[model samples]
Target: MGNSSSIQAADASGFTQSRSLSRSFFGAAALALVIILPGCATYSSGFAKVEQAAAVRDLDGAVKTLDELKLTGADEALHHLNKGTLLRLQGNYAESNKHFDIAKELADKLNAISVSEQLASVSVNDTMKAYEGLPSEQLMLYSFKALNYLQMSDVDAAAVEARQFDIKQSQIAKQNADAKYLSGAFVRYLNAMVYEAAGERDSARIELQKALDGYKKQNSGFPVPASLTADLARIKAGKPAPSEVVFILQNGLGPSLHEATVRIANPNPQNGSSLLSLAVPKLAKRSVPVARIELSAGSAVASAEVVEDVNDIAEKSLNDRLPGITARAVARMVVKNAAVGETKKRSNELGAFGLLANIAMDVGSAVSERADTRTWSLLPGVINMARLPLPAGKHDITATYYSESGAVLATRVFKDIEIKPGRKAFVSDYYLNPPAQAKAPQ
Candidate 1:
């Protein structure tokens, strides 16, 4: 699976609520002075710096400087919108959504009643016209809305919104290559997602390729949100459809060392069942299987074997000459000739999956006072066993590092609070401690 960082929050309301009026007054006085004084290039210079920071992924710097701009009350909506964009880059979706909502509200208030009515009609022409008057801040808001729609599996609506943005730019004779690329690429991406969901493997692969090409041409590289890349790869490979499987790898999280590993096998060897595997190293002592689905048609039947601990096999020496592990011993399946479809009915069963382990190193011959040991899992998208079904409320998730034999070395806990969904409001801080070192008995 492709690994990448999460999208940052792009909400701008926090900046607007705190620094609107005073900046407006100061900006007017500065404008008058600019006419009298000749050396005032601060505004242009500052905005340029912010843009540069954003391009390079320095989101914090971009947000800090953008917040300092002193736009008039008329431009307040746009300012908040820009802030939202910065937050989105930082992967704060909830806050980014808040800014988008606020921007929409402000835009509604400023527009003529008739203009609002026309926009509400959802006509492309009318929406294009309405978008033109919007400040730069809201451009990203439209982009984010389109992205959200895609996430919700509403491809048609996303395509419509993207088209509106494209048409509006053409009508105004304003060319934003980045915006154009994003609109085109996103629509294609959504189309691919729809095709994948419908089990049209070839069609999905073609569309995803188009989307990837468009994004690369526009931004000169793959999109920053790495999740899309993994999805694209899965589609191209014709593995468990994107809708049927989820990849949990993200950027900034350290290497997945002990997470589970999953593998899928085909029951009928001739038709070549799709084989998919992922290694999740951050969740548990060994990786857990996220999915091990079986697919078949008519007389052709295929099964997937998901193994959690492949490390055991890796640990054994080939010289040992032992049957390390077998596929049937570790996986679940569905047979087309089952008397009563028992396999199909119990497809969700995970208890049957087993690990193929090998004894890598013998601790019996160790001479040191402390022994260090490491284990690995072979599946991807497995959630941390300790952090599953987090209760609704705010929580701080932490990861602790350990030295092979299980000696705690360091711990890291994220400060950002995540709101869970529940009335009782469960709030707790999680810890990731390093493994401890084992002491040999004297």
Candidate 2:
């Protein structure tokens, strides 16, 4: 993330360099060389390359590359700005701030004289247009500036630049949803961090939730950073201690059906496990061939599945009764693994069902069609549940079915379910149609 001081430096340095370079022969040659280089040229080619490396968190490379760039008559302000950004990325905040201050001074000088009035008058739209035709090096410079602001906790300013960056990127070529989502998410998260720093707990919470929601909508299950998680726990507990909830599902075979026991493992001493069970019918004539079961919290299935199958064989006469059998599998479920948080309940919708709806929305419209087309087998499989977790909040639930060939055969999302803590929320009654279903109990 970029810091405010570093951002000040980057802006000052970039503008100053542009101005000075415009007047210097060597500066012009350097710019020309950048233009002539292959699109995949090394990072030493342009000023923006340093910024690009910083954006991707490659601080060392960015710093080393910047040092090697022989900028004849480069604006001192720009040099300091680049140096400050690299320093910030390296965690040398004090040094970064010093450089930023120098860049700011240079900027002040230029602003006083109204040097490069044409560039100074560039509108946001013009900047956006220019960004479209910008070489990779220029794009990197913009990225570095945005990141510097983000790190400095000046989210609003960073957002403005980020938006410009996105628009310019789109004008150059079509933008991917993932890329857009990442940029948006980073902005939201930085804003939330700023709120947290300001001691506005409620506002911080809201921003953080928004950030989480945005990430979920994108179907990106990136884990919440530890700092953010700590902030939420503090808010919830009205104190400064960390707490986490873990859900575990243990599967065991019974005489006639498959039994699953779910338990919550709270790290805090004050919290206790909340256990539940789901009894699935076993196959009448043959043993259940359940290779795996996946579960997740907040109305969704788990992130992982219990997959190792247990086999038991015993010699039995035609007239002898079969012996009882038992096998076990385990899965861990948690809220953070979900792409989105719980879904809000709508009228006539149960909590788990509402969660499913949210899942469908997050996953997108093509999911059902894709499921029907046997794409489910290719997708990750989630165990379907009639009962789901909803702790006095919103939740979304989804189940994806996989074929024997490991292709996604179907996917279903249950949306907008509300359930109070210690209460039960039921989901829509649905069943998977499969050859394995006949072998498993109803």
Candidate 3:
């Protein structure tokens, strides 16, 4: 919370309630702050109309709604990220990349802030600051940008993104040695394929190994794709293998943050049933539609398994930062309590004006206690991948995504996929669960 001192605890004891001013005038300023600003707003409520459109696969409508909202300030980065993903899903790769570029620049600028700089903004709340994005969101920004390039058949640009992501994650890993989200194994797996497509076998092999090491090192709760092992072994033999079809699937929606308020016990029981309520952000997991993706390229088949669980990474990422968030909240509440207590003290002496002042102070304290819930809400919860090595020729590929309960949720088919010798072709998709079917009575 920044600039919280703007609310002074001092009383205007001499201000007359009768002929000097209308009774309503006394509370106007305080009421304005509470009424005019979205101090207690959450992401879900703000994005409700747009999300409703997206829930039904009306992506164009969703994009249009977002455009109409014209969100600004700290959340502009997330707005761009949402638009970019929606556009990508619509197969608008160029436009998607343009928006992603804007988001990347904004995030990079915010990331330049030092710890001291952040501490200086202690009085400024999260809603007022530029969003730098969480580690998982930042990582996916690179991944989606690369995927957009790949969709446009721009292997070189994709490779460039791969390298940049590698450098970025390396720096992140060094700074946060114990952060499991630093693994970047999903992105590494993707980069390996990008290198392979670029005819950089040595770089491809190296990245594949790095991906293996990252998966093991991070222990991110996702089992390494068994296909990765087969990939490394085959590449190690240095044989000129036929080109392959790599099916990349982004599965289910990612988790979102919601406010969770906890009431702390009173240090002195005489004070009442509660001391203060601490508001914090908590991850709300999204639906899990695609548990496994079964892919078949003619006779050759491979099952795409989880390379990354974004929900888990996002949860762990937020958990790592909660201590600092909690501490700031505690400090902010202390400031609010002092202001409220001051108003309460002068309420009797100041008469009607003081009572109104007390009411405003109480409202301000509750409104200011809201938790920040912004996030890259459009991202998928899981990244699933499968590889099929076919002889250099045209082949038919079928991909079917399943739920954990083994129900078929979706199926995608790519016809006449051509694979060249010593190269890789990719077929990628994003999936959401079909409308939940009505169940029969038992």
Best by lDDT: 3
Q: Can you give the TM-score per candidate against the true fold?
A: 0.29, 0.27, 0.85
Q: Best candidate per TM-score, number? A: 3
The global Cα lDDT (0 to 1) of model 1 is 0.36
lDDT string for model 1 (1-442, tens) is: 1232222222355456345544543443343243223212222224545555654557788788787864444345555566665665566655766776676677656555465444322211111122212222233345465544544445566555555545543432244433333334544554555555445668667767766665565452223235447667765565664112111111111112222345554354222212322222222222221222222222322222211112222222111211211121122111111211222222213222200000000010010011001111111111111212243444444444333455544444444334323211111111221112211112
Per-candidate RMSD, Å: 32.2, 31.7, 7.8
Per-residue alpha-carbon lDDT of candidate 3 for residues 1-442, written as tens digits (9 for 90 to 100): 3344433322233334343444443543354365226464544446756656765678899899888774657677888898998898887899999999999888888888767546433432445556777776788788889888987889999999999998888778887888866778888888988888888989989999999998897687878789778778878998654678878777777876777877665474222212454577877887767777899976788888788888888888898989988887777666555545554564435566655655565555565566778888778878888888888889989998877889887778889988778767777788865444311112
Candidate 3 RMSD to the correct structure: 7.8
lDDT, residue 132, model 2: 14
TM-score of 3: 0.85
The global C-alpha lDDT for each of the candidates, from Candidate 1 onward, is 0.36, 0.36, 0.74
List where candidate 3 sits over 4 angstroms from the true fold: 1-28, 31-36, 40-44, 48-52, 113-121, 263-275, 342-349, 435-442
Error of 3 at 265 (Å): 9.7
Clash-forming residue pairs, model 3: 1-123, 1-124, 2-123, 2-124, 2-125, 3-123
Better candidate number, 1 or 3, judged by lDDT:
3
Displacement of the residue 120 alpha carbon in candidate 2, Å: 17
Clash number for candidate 2 = 52
